[model samples]
Target: MKILVLLGALALAGCASKPVPPDWQADAKGALDGFTDDYLKGNTAAAEAEFRQARLATTATGRADHVAQVELVRCAAQAASLVFEDCPGYATLAADATATQRAYADYLAGRWQGLDPELLPEQHRPVLAGGPIGAVADPLARLVAAGAAFKAGRITPEGIAQAVETASNQGWRRPLLTWLGIQAQRADAAGDAAAATQIRRRIALAAGQR
Candidate 1:
């Protein structure tokens, strides 16, 4: 699906790899957490090394899925500079993100909208991973609260809209674009053609397409 192509960049970034065997997952989250802590303290060098070690530990399992997850952290460390914004270790991260967003938007143009957030699987949520380099954003509690609201059937688009705005404000570029594309699809599905068109256009602009 177009959504998968758009998200592949981030998914492959390493947080949500395949559900590995229990033994592998036991250390996966901790590896990420340790890296998170180290990066938050501005000890990126140490974090990188720590992450590399964690990734290596996955080798014993020979679980491609778990290894991919660990490698995501390793990738972050590779791209990470002493500065936080630097990551994915490859110079093409931004261009790749831009291209992916463009492809998603183009795919959505003229498609039926009416999308429901509830229909999106957990793995498909448009949230970015990684803590800030010298700062932390353990918004996990908040995320859980939001998710609970959905489970309680008390969630509102307004709340998601606010979160989307916040993500944009925080400069989480790829997630912001992905969220916008989803909103556009929902608007189309809601029969708000005008809004949908506008959203598609915005998505295009964000993707540097039109």
Candidate 2:
């Protein structure tokens, strides 16, 4: 009697819980990874196509938060590559974003005031605390920190060097060339003509112009 009734209710509740569709999950993850890989390798057209597929898969979930998260992934990759454009996609969904997502968005945009470090990924947490960028273990995380620090006008020559090294080590040509160009400009500004010329050669080599 009572046991049977309770069992029926429990079964009904379980049936009502919708599981995530496997296809959506696979499509989203695969496309996002493809986009990141292509973008980092400087394949702009392929990255754009992959990102479109990712967005479509995420949008199928009918969850604004999920869509916003995909946008954040794109923004983070762009940040790591030193492209500091406004994260317009995330901005559109911001009102529906979770507190942590909003905080991450702000962090990517270099808006540090009132930012909650705990809301950020562990690798990015130290950046908010003014800790050394070299302390971040992951190469991509280090590049991300360097981009943020550059946005905040807080990046030093050492920080730029670390970012250049990280990108070069990873064979991330896009960011490597960008960082090398910046290093060259810094050297030129300081009247280090020899150093600037050397950096320019590295940039040319990285750009496949050599």
**What is candidate 2's lDDT per residue for 1-210, written digit by digit as tens?**
011110111121234377644677667777777887788889999999998998998798889887888888888789888898798998899999888888878887888888889988777888788888888887767877888888777888888999999899989999999999999999989999999999999988999998
Provide TM-scores for the models.
0.35, 0.88
Provide the overall lDDT of each model, using Cα atoms, as 2-decimal numbers.
Answer: 0.42, 0.80
Best by TM-score: 2
- lDDT digits (tens) for residues 1-210 of candidate 1: 111211232232335575544544445455565764465334668767766666666667655444544543433322211122322322233243333332222112211134333333333233212122112132322222233333333435664454345445544444446557657877988999998898788767766797
- Tell me the TM-score of model 1: 0.35
**Candidate No. with top lDDT:** 2
Report RMSD for candidate 2: 9.6
The list of candidate 2 runs beyond 4 A from truth reads 1-21
